[model samples]
Target: MYKPQLNMESLERCVKSLEENENNVRDEAQKALLNICRNVLRSPNDDKTREVRLDDEVVVEKLLPAIGAMECLFDVGYVEDGERLFLPGNVSLSRLQSLSKLLSAVSESKPVTKDIEENSTAQKAFFKKISKDFHNVMHYEDPDLQKKARSVIPIAQLEIAAMTKMRHLQKSYKFSDARKTTSSTQFETELTAKDLLLVELLHWFKHEFFEWVNSPKCSRCSTECVYESVVPSTNHRCSRIELHRCEKCNIIVEFPRYSHPEPLLTLRRGRCGEWANVFTLLCRSLGYDARFIYDETDHVWTEIWSASSKKWIHLDPCENVIDKPLMYEKGWKKKLTYVIAYSKDEVQDVTWRYTQDQEAIMKRRKICTEESLIQFLRSLTDQRQNSSNYSSARKNYVIMRSLLELADMLYIPNLQNKNSNEIYEGRTSGSLAWRLARGEIVQADIEKNYIWDVSKYGKMFELRYNIVKDIYHVVHNDGTILEQKSGWQEGTNITNGGIFRKVENDWKMVYLTRSPQAQYGCIKWIFEIANSELYLETFKLRTKSEVFHGARVSWKIEAIFSDDKVIVIPVSNCNNFYTEDVRKAVKLNIIVTLSGGQGQTAWQHAQVFRQSLENIEEASMIINIQLKNH
Candidate 1:
């Protein structure tokens, strides 16, 4: 349970110390730790690996002196010990991932780099003029991007193995009834079957198909490795190769960091770059009009045109997130400069969709003037559109969509307790230290307690007070048992010996009984209005029983609108009926409280009348209401 933090500085020191050793002690230690990590990863459910004897020869000789290796082992849930290191429970998948990251860190030679490539002739020339850093933003303009994307379609389509995986992704959730609303945005049209497929694809790609490589395993010894240097690659598809030395065997291993998705289909590894590349290609293979989205702050993702929403929707295969445009800026605290999206037929500067801090982003855009950048984007877009042969009507629709998106970007809303997509936390896929190094960690605020949050129906209620714990019963005047408890708590049943007493002539009675120890008991019921134009004509409350022993009854009615506005009406000892016109009520709350009551509180039937604006048809709004005593 007590997991120690992996200290990279200590690990670096240990690596250096081991390298300076006169014998093969360092190799033996590195091999021992690597074996432990590999075994746990390979068969996490094996009970044999749940504990390690601290007195074992290898642990005492090879691991104890290797402080860094021991630290990593402790970090990955091997710290529990009573003279023996014992894993407390089933190995956590996250802890296993953390172990992999630790193995990569000591062997890594350089920081993680972006997968960069020149897009077009103009883009290549432009990068030559501007700083090389800006090329990440401009690489989306590659005219042959679609051709490259289409290349991988046959891999997933023609191959029986790949098709089996794709078929697995198509199996949808049984309860997947499509809705027009998401957490953040509501669409004009309901989600189509295609949208659901894309959602399923994201899940399958992240969990099943892809594996993130922090550091490639050594081909010779399959143990820990150290990065040596870059070398020439014989393959034309791969532009460069990285060499890593097996810490155990001292054999050189070649890692060809390929950007091409074709080979990536077989390799199925790398960081965010490979993820986005293969995922985008897969999207194209599936006939979804997908875009390769490039973030100037060194991230890559995908976007697809949604036929239902009639706009581009953001999808991050690496994070398994969809339509969370603000994740990079708000969640990851990334200082974004330019977020450009490129598809076969178009290229656009979509940075506005991702961040609200345009002023700061513009200030950071120092590699090229804003005007020149705009000109370059426009020139590239124009070239694509002119060649694509889009009709006049199609062009107008595209322009209109862009304007709508721009307007949406400029419009700021009061997000407090409103925005459904609460992307206020950091990245989830990477290791803790890796996330920390990337400045992607965000401290979360205190969690909130919600009374009701059925966001799918666009309804939510915030309760400030903890409800009274006592239970109560609602019965008819003749004691025919309108409603009663069903064994939720001990002694919840009402007194069974007596029937309700008859009320005054021509008046029926409904009563509520409070718990004996409770000072104040209340019952509240919620009513959902079916139509917007319905209005409450009158609310009548009459006491059937005369007051006795300083007992009192009070009632409150709350009409909550769709905009979260609430109107409250409270009345006490209402011997006479009252008429109040409640209009356009989306939800209605009725609460009746009996305070300082020793006996049951009887009412001569509370009646609520509703009338439609179109037709004056009166109806009782309350039906089958329940009462709970304090």
Candidate 2:
């Protein structure tokens, strides 16, 4: 009746004894181990008092929250771990698109297959796991890909082929049988780690609640076809080509490698064109007969002539043709059959491994280069920002993950759990939150776990992770710029843009509106999320130095949502900043703040200000720039 405690000793033993005989015992044991790992860092050892009300009656509150300096906790999955977990086959397609973003940050020169060619059991297991995970995501209906020879396709082939492989490839290698279980070498451990994680992920997919095999089937009669193919009869529309099963035969595209056939064996959501692009990418990377059909479908799929298997095969990820043909007009018994349609783009002047102009190759290389990574990170930074700059901090969440991928590939270790933000925060070696904000840790330390290089485990990858993490913040131009004064205290005399010094005595407040004239999307934020959160206990500013002065200040911002900022001078106008063009035309002199941060980089404002149409036409209350001539 008693549950076991989750601790390192128990969990390590649990992971070691993964192939247990009993399922229930294994589940409980694994749960205990994973829970201990996941909750290790979150234990009650902190000092900050924070309250989180889960609901009116329920609250998960933390007080005396002590931020760990060197305390380490791992987030291995347990029961609660399902919250953020990628539940196997149910993972979102948009989430998988994240792989594009993930790989985009790494250098092209870096090897994409750190775990691919390992000559050990663990290595083979890891590769298999990766291949299997990839296999689940792939829904190509084509069944002929298995017979193709492997390796990079020549440029000539790509030019002649219909499809070209580009990125994201998974391949496998095996160690000599005698050396597969040799635990003495580091390779064995690396292989084990890779394989175990991969298999775990596949098992997760296989047991998914909505796995293809679990998809609802047609209730008409007892059953029909259980195939994963995109079979459509000439007389039937796609809406009618729903899931079905046949009691006579378990009709599904069955792979020799798999014991059971399921929809994932060859069914993707996209049409022929989308499926072709994937095949092209896969085959180009692995040398195959992938071609782009230049017809209305523009379908890009791969092909192979299996001399042994006899039939010419198609790796149509869009339609699994394992048991039968995917009909085109064949559904209506029309002349244009599936075979005829596929034959349309069968072969043209170009091959699958086609090369492009030097510009494209250079461009792809540049975009995914180490230098490019640095530039992107720097582009995200605001050089003039002090500690108070929280405007673009949210983007750092994505940045953190992308940088982590790069770090892991380079064999970085300390980077795996780096609180490296100290460099960006302009602080000493100690940064509490930075350590916890490792959103990029998962992919950044990808292959570092089991590299062959001895120094790599200790230094190389560790160094890379640190370097990448530091660069990300640097690119973002992050730092804790210590002010000349001890603490920040605002006052009434907030210069044109800066608030006054004494305003901080109590929380002096003012109403800000989107400038009447904003050229770009600058005015969008003010109307969008300006009043999202409220600041209470506010002070007010007078229209003029004294109450009811003739001069007034006009604002363009509108507080839309949450609590409103108290407005003392609701309707007023003052000398708004003037433009040089207007100044030259008027021949009048007035002092005003001309430029904020302008024209330095890509995304900034102050150079071009525009007024919205509503503000211009609906002149119910007017606040125009004033003139002062001496």
Candidate 3:
């Protein structure tokens, strides 16, 4: 007999490694020990002869509840990663399975058209009320709210009915060989049956998310390109983009921006691939056992065996609806627009597609349409739109949990430094700017207020000799470095951050910093060589609103060398904070000075500046005195 270690120390090790285990070691240990044979409850498994050993009971008593506890915690979080949810060890699988069965029985007990547990008199009133409610709902101007409300209850009701039918059928089936059931035919068939129930659950979840999204009533951009998927309603400033679509309808959409996903599904490099990965993660996280299969034609889908609905469902997110062919067929209904082929490499793992299975798949497809997936909403509902949010739904709760864990384990220690000016891109703003001691320039002009001046584009100004060329460096979120080097394109421009075709320059640039928060935004540096001299400066503001803010402002005055890059050094005026060309220096402000140089062949320079200093660098530049907040 193996001695069981019941101490927290040993259990803690088990808990940690359970997540780290790739061989399903933790899961096997857990399942083998959890919920010692219970006669009071019925299991989806048909076999009832297995005996629970003493150690098995001990494992359940000691570790089962700990696992089940995760279900109650909607916000399961990673230890430094409060941005995501964490599944605890206390979720009771038995309890969940039981609830699923019960919910299913409710739907199957009496068809919606019929009500009342015992008497016809009660049925009459229930039907009458439902009829009246439906009529009133249609009269409302905003049908969405009522429509969602309508979707929620009916879905729940349908799930209950379907589950009840499934409970009866499941009693006759044996799943003892689940892990070892390698027969693709049998495994595929069973997998479909399980997915039916999972899809039913997703329907209600979809409706619930919309309730949260719409409750705040804010203006949303439904343009083909923009996505507004914020949650909790009132946090408007925090709203972010959910997904990005290219200009082609045929183009595939990418969500969450992860590397390509294959071996699970053969989706191409775009939207189809994204949807497959998102749906697969969500389904498994929700406790719905599913398998991803790809067809030779590259189609992917899942089958859910819903013991509650007494059927297996086919779910195809790409179709934007549930594929309910068999169930509708059983009812003698013709093929509706919602049905489609669900194949994995030109094969479907099912011997039969029952009515319950058909209905469950169709329902889930409707709920999990791309428009309603957590991947879409969470990707949008964050300050960065980087998939940082807590989804209350069952699927998202676990997926979020796993992501939180993965993020924590994979996070690089110096990650923030890598994102020095990354937030400007996170904002997905049309414009980007860089500010530094050199000067300011615009690679792409985004200010509608000054779009008319094509002159500001190609103007190149010479500030020093060593600042040879106008080029800068940028770092992406993935830690890749990008060098931004631009010059006068084919089109004729006066040249640089100055004016084109204009005889004189009209702006000056200065470097300024106010607070730590302000330091996080985008800043670009640009260098220009015009009239045999090199001009160095920065263009580092994502928007025009940040052009002027109080802080320290400085001009570059280092000695210029004939054949070297311009050495940049800060120069302060007697007033302690003033620019040579500036008349009035405002506190908490940023300035780019305009300088005109005489030359029939005039030139200008600019760049985007992004710098993240370490603690040592910060300490060296720290000012003792605290300044008033701007």
The lDDT leader among the candidates is 1
The predicted structure with the larger lDDT, 1 or 2, is 1
For candidate 2, report its TM-score. 0.19
Ranking by TM-score: 1, 3, 2
User: What is the TM-score of each predicted model, taking all chains together?
Assistant: 0.44, 0.19, 0.20
- The lowest-lDDT stretch of 10 consecutive residues in candidate 2 is 460-469
Better of 2 and 3 by lDDT: 3
- What global local distance difference test value does model 2 have? 0.24
User: Candidate 1 — which residues are off by over 4 angstroms?
Assistant: 1-188, 232-236, 388-401, 412-421, 443-630
Cα error, residue 20 of model 2, in Å, equals 31
Tens-place lDDT per residue, model 1, 1-630, is: 122334333233334433433346656776787677677667777756665655355565576544244545665556422224555453355665645554455456433222222343334444443332233323333446546545534343334444454444334422244332332123214545567668767877898888876556667655545445555577866756766667667788777877566678778887787899788877876677777887855688999888777677889998899988888888887777778776655567788888767776775554445666777777766665565456767667667866766665655333322574675667866543335334465322222221221121222211111002222233343434433332112211122111111211112222333322234544455555443334333444442323346666556768677789999977554444353534455556655555553332222122111112222222112122211111
Per-residue lDDT over 18-57 for candidate 2, one digit per residue giving the tens place of the 0 to 100 score: 3222554433433332333233334323211111111111
RMSD of 1: 22.5
Error of 3 at 125 (Å): 38
